[model samples]
Target chain A: MLKIDNLHATAGDKEILKGISLTVNAGEVHAIMGPNGSGKSTLAQIIAGHPGYVVTAGSVTYEGKDLLAMPAEERAQAGVFLAFQYPVEIPGVTNAYFFRSAYNEVRKANGKEELDPIEFLDLMEKKLKLVEMDEAMLHRSVNAGFSGGEKKRNEILQMAVLEPKLAILDETDSGLDIDALRVVAGGVNALRRPDNATIVVTHYQRLLNYIVPDFVHVLAHGRIVKSGGKELALELEARGYDWVMEAA
Target chain B: MATATNATGEAYEQAFGALRAQGGPSWLPALRREAMDRFSALGFPTTRNEDWHFTSVTPIAERVFKVAPTRSGPATLSPADVAALVISDPDWHRLVFVNGRFEASLSAFAGLPADVRVTTLADALKESPEFVAEHLGKLASGEGQTFTAFNTAFAQDGVVIHVPGGEIVEAPVHIVHIADAQAAGAGIHPRLLVVAEALSRLTIIESFASTGSFGAPYLTNAVAEIEVGNGARVDHYKIQRESTDAFHVGTTQVRQGRDSMYHSFSYAAGAAISRTNVYTQLAGENGETRLNGLYLIDGTQHADHQTFVEHLAPGCASRELYKGILDGSSHGVFNGKVYVDPVAQKTDGKQTNHALLLSEHARVDTKPQLEIFADDVKCTHGATVGRLDEDALFYMKSRGLGAENARALLTYAFAAEVLETIEVDALREGLEALAFARFTQSFGEQR
Candidate 1:
């Protein structure tokens, strides 16, 4: 469902993604692990169409369409979702209102009827339970003063509501406690389907225990240095990223 | 003494001549005489004056606006037309003024409480001369304020609301100042006097509107003098919705007594050139003052809001938040000052002015002044001018909202910070609708 070939991207004068290639099919969950500043998050941001990075020398194809050619909003409407590691805090805008606007926008783009307040509330209630979020969070400003774990849960709640075809979780496991990690991972595990895909990008191997990945890839110096089945994650966790870095 | 040139000077002289011809109350002539002398001395405040540095009244001065005919027979507008201009609150006691004169037919004074003395200023002067004489022009002085001086000198008819001591007015007093098109190229001075006695409570909604479409530009120079007595509470809201070609210069002066509360909100949504000055002084201990404003200007419109809050007594608090959203070639200016006097120990004051520019030609100039003379007082003021947050825009876009819709929503949210502070339900909803319409229209005009 997704393919990246020799993707070389730069942010300003510094190159972040150099000669990176990856592929993923439907129903697959892939984990991309790397040390800090190893381009793990950069790859995920580029896929989600963040404007800060320029794709210099490669193409990204999603279902035979040029994904990079679309704008960020268009990519979202096309069922590409990015759960930002640091969700922007927008004061004076309620979480429920923001979610409703976003949900209706995607619906309108797909030629679906928009849901009214009542219908949207019902959907939100259902999704809130998936991530174990309190109903009070809906009335507060969007991510304003929310705890780190609550912010992560809110992102997963959005994912559940939008039901995107391809989801990228960038550093979703970072800064989460054990219980919050389980809640977030459990929601993702429940939403997985054979027709949908997910890419988990993290700096730790602990999240793989909750939402086990079909494959694991070690990213070093903006390139995938090692690729293997799920066991590779345990191997790296026992050792360290240094072994993979030296080998690459 | 300094004097204006050409048409501007002639307009003042014409107003003085008319005031002489029309006999007023016993004290009115002397007050008008003093004001005329002050106007002649001050002329018009130029940019050279620090207070008027960002806003110029040259456009208003250049055009000559004759005095609107007082008691212009009967208003030709129907009740439905009047209803459209008001907030349509059934319980609100309304005093409707047309072309600066009392429209007794449209006013609903009988609905007010028995203890409340709500009547037109003209009627109050003739009937209750003592009450009118004691409080009128006491809180709002025309000494240094150019527009207040002009308004006081030529004032005709406005609302005079006096709630006796210990009386609580449940329903808000609505004062509607409608400038009819018949008074084209005319100047209408509408004055309001609100006196809430000790332990009393009252709410006032003052609306300045134009009756016809843009054509000949008129001027509405208004002044509202509010006095909140000891332990009293007062909420005052002023809505300026004049014609696109019209000009408005308004002054709202409030003084709070011991343990009193004063809340004032001004929304400037119309007029080619609109300047609103809000000044408040905490005269007693434990008084609370809140001054909030929102100005949305588009096209070639210009809106200026100058606010001054003085902390005279100890244990007083004041908060001010003014937000402006400018689109097209519009310009906005906000100058807010919070003064903590030497005797105002333990005074807590905060002031913030934020402006959002939607287009390249749109501009805003904001200055927040904090003068702290008390050693133990806490005062802070900040001013920020910028376009919309790009990161916020992208975040919204990635959530599937269109770029235009996202930008419009952000702009609306920025204005809501001030709009939401309004305690009146009907007024808040009405302003929200007006703001929404303005944003939609302007955002659609953008590329």
Candidate 2:
């Protein structure tokens, strides 16, 4: 579903992602594990078309189309979703309204009729149950004064509503407690299908316990150096990333 | 203080002479004489003056305007057009005026209660001369105001409302002033006087709008004097939507008695140049006052709001909030001052002005001043000038909204803060629809 070949990216003068290459097909989940400053988040951002990062070399193709050339909004309309690590707070814009706008935009791009407010609200109620969110949160401002767990869950709720083909979960379990992690992982597990794919980026192996990945790749110094089965996460958790760095 | 007679000043003098030649009441001539003398001495306000620093009245002073003629036969507008301009609800009393002249055929006051008086200034002069003589030039004295002096000198007709003591007026009173361009350089002065007796409650909505596009610029000089008695409550709202080629200058003076509450909301969106001066005096103890205003201007339009609040009694509270949105090369000005007297101990006062600029060439000048003479008073004032939040824009854009849609949403959100302050739900909803239409036109299509 997605392909990245020798992706070289930088923010300002510092090169973050250096000579990284990855490929993921449909019906598979890939876990990119790395230590701090290992360019795991940078790779996710580049795939979602963040304007701040400059790709110095290499290419990214999504569904046989060049994803790097498209604008951020166009990529979103083209079914690319990025669950942000730190969700931005937009005052005076209700979450329900924003979500409906995004959903309609994507639907329009796919040549589907836009849903009215009543129709959208009916659809939203079903999605709210998937994330264990209160209906009151829909009326509140977008991520304003939200708790850490709530923000992460709201991001997941957006993912469920949009139903993107290629979703990148960037540090989705960083600040979540054990109960929230279970619920979030359960929501992600329910969304897995035969025609869609997810790339989970995390620093800890504890998340893989709930949403088990098919392949665990260890990213070190801006490159994925090790790829193995689900048992690799347990070994790394027992031995630590220092052992993987030495082996790489 | 600067008595420099320019061409505009000389033309006003000529107009005053003509009014004297065609006289009215015995007392009006003397008031006109005194006002014209004051207007001649002070002349038009210039940018050099501290009060008129940001707003220059040069455009008004350079033009020569003749006095708006009296009803030259019947009005040209149909009943449907008049109905279209009115607020949709019919539970209120409406006093309609065309070209600054009261139209008895167009007005409707079917359900007004007895003992409450709502009539035109011209009718009250003959019907209740003694009452009109007592309150005509009493509350809003043309002391240092040139435009108020001009209005006092030339005002022929307007709205005069009086509510008796211990009465709760359930229906709102709307006074609609429609300025039609029948002739070029026609200047009209419309005066309003509202007196609420002790323990009374009322709401007054005054709107100034133009009928059609005027080939030549006309002037609408309006003044409203409101007196709130002891323990009374009054809500005064003014909406100004004139023609693009028109110029409007209005002054509103309010006096609140002991334990009285007075609120004023001014929404300005039209006209080439418009200035509204609002002054409130908290004269008695435990008085409460709120002054709120919102202005939206684009193209080369200019809108200015000047406000002054005086806390003269102890235990009085006053708060003021004014917001402006300027686009293109439009200009906006806000000058607000809050003064606490020496005897006004334990007084609370706060003032804030915020401006959002949509274009680089748009300009806003805001000045909030606080003068506290009592040691026990709490007074604070602040002013801010800024553009849209960039982080908020990027956050919206990342959600699949196009650039124009994202900007339009943020701009609506910015102006909605001020709209939320309105108390009347119906009025608020109507204004919101108007605001939505305005922003959609100002920005592009909505997503």
Candidate 3:
């Protein structure tokens, strides 16, 4: 469902994603593991179409459609979702109102009818139960005064509502506790289907324990140095990315 | 700094001249003449005036505003028109006006509480000349103020609300003022007099808005006198969302009796330049007072709030909080002061003003002052000027909200605190819609 070939990106004069490439098909979860400054997160951001980081070379296509040509919002409507490491807080805007607007935008993009208040509420009720999140969260401002874990849960809550085709979890496991991780992972696993995909970007191998990935790639120095099956994450955790960096 | 002065100055002189014919009790014309003499004596305020510091109204002073809609003041509001500003509570009564003039033909005053009474200023003047003579320009008025003198001289028709003694109104009351800008250079000077008798209760909302694309640079200068009698309670809200090019200057002077409670909540979002002044005097011991304001400005809009609270009697309490969010090149100012007399002991007062600058070009100037002569009193005052928390902004973005959307939401939330302070549901809802639209436009959609 997603393909990136020799991604070359930079922040100003400094290069971040030098020449990294990866591909993920439907129903498959791919984990990109790397150390600090290894450009793993940059690859995820560039793919999400964050402006600031100039994509100088390479190409990314989703379902054979040009990805880099679209704006961040359009990319989102195109089923490209990114679970940011930190969530933004919007005061006076309730979770219900925000999610409804987002859902309608995407549905409208796909030539689908917008859901009325009642219909939207019903959809959110089901997703709320799926993520084990309460309606109380929907009544409050968007992520205002929410905890780290709750924010990550909100990210998953939005993911569940939008039901994206290719989801990019950018350090999604950074702030979650043990129980939260299980809930988040369960929700993510529940959404996995043959027509959708997941790309887990993390510096640790712990998140892989709940929702195992089909392929684990060690990203060091802005390039993929090693690629293997799920066992590769455990190997990287035990030995560290120093070996991967040296090999690169 | 090249002001629109010559225009406003000429306009003020013209409006002030045409109003001299509105003779009341002979004392009133004498007062107007004196005020006019004082205004000209004062001339246009320079930076030297302490109150005018940081705010150079020279531009406002120069531009001339054509005499307001008085020529076509009384307007008809259809039921559809009322719905645009209606609050859904069937329990209360409402009196809607068009451009500061009373429109009894279109207003509904059925089944009003017995103790609650209302009359147009013109009607009240004819029915009870005693009350008009006794209270006219009684609380506060001055020729030193060009606009106040102007409003007094014109002394156009307004509303007089009196909640009789021992009557506590269960429902709210609204006075909606809509301006017709179809007439070029027309202006509106709406006035209000609210008197809550002993042990009475009242809630009033005074809103100023405009319709049509007359597109002329009109102006509105308004003043309200509120009196809360002994043991009475009053919640007053002033919502000003005039046209973007309109200039609004208003004053609210309140007098509280022993053990009375008075609250003033104001939200300013429109107008090219707007200034609202609130003055309250704790006349009797144990009186309570609160003054709050939320002014959100973007682009070239400028909003300024100046307030003063006095503790004349002992055992009184007062609180004031004003917040603003400025985007683009908009500017904001807040100057608040609390005064405690020597005999006014046991006064508990707190004042706080904060501004959140949303852009580098957006500027805010805030100052809080306290002058206490009493020995036993608790007084606190503070002012803060800054921007939205960056950490807070990034946190919103992390939740799939774009950077612009995050900023917009946070700014709206920042101003929501002031909106919540509005006790009137209809007024609050109206303000909420306006503030939401404002921030949304500035920050755009973030879905």
Q: Identify the leading candidate in terms of lDDT.
A: 1
Please, what are the lDDT tens digits per residue for candidate 3 over residues B1-447? 122255555566676777766655556667767766565556556657777676766555655556555434445567577556543344556677776667776567666676577877778777776776676667757535666765665657778887889987777776777776553466676777888899999888777777666566777888888899999999988878887878888888899999999999988887888989899999999999999999888889889899999999999999998999888899998999899999999999999898999789999988787899999999998888988876665444433455676567778788886787887676678678777787878667434
Per-residue CA lDDT of model 2 for A1-248, tens digit only, reads: 89999999999999998888889998899999989999999898888777789999999999999999987778888888888888888766789889998889888978999999999999999999998999999998889899999999999999999888888899999999999999899889888999999999999999999989999999998889899988998998998899889988
Provide a comma-separated list of chain B TM-scores, one per candidate: 0.96, 0.96, 0.90
* lDDT accuracy of residue A181 in candidate 2: 97
Indicate the residue-level lDDT of A199 in model 2: 93
What's the TM-score of each model vs. the native?
A: 0.97, 0.90, 0.80
lDDT score of residue B381 within candidate 2: 86
Tell me how large the interface RMSD of candidate 1 is.
1.1
- Please compute DockQ, using alpha carbons, for every candidate against the native two-chain complex: 0.72, 0.50, 0.17
Error of 2 at B97 (Å): 1.5
lDDT of candidate 1 over B271-379, digit per residue (tens): 9999999999999999999999999888899999999899999999999998988888999999998889999999999898899888899989888888889999888
Count clashes in each candidate, considering only residues at least 3 apart in sequence or on different chains.
0, 0, 20
Greater TM-score among 1 and 3 belongs to 1
Q: Flag regions of model 2 displaced more than 4 Å.
A: A12-14, A30-44, A144-151, A170-186, A201-248, B1-7, B21-25, B83-88, B343-348, B376-382, B445-447
- Please say which candidate is ahead in DockQ: 1 or 2: 1
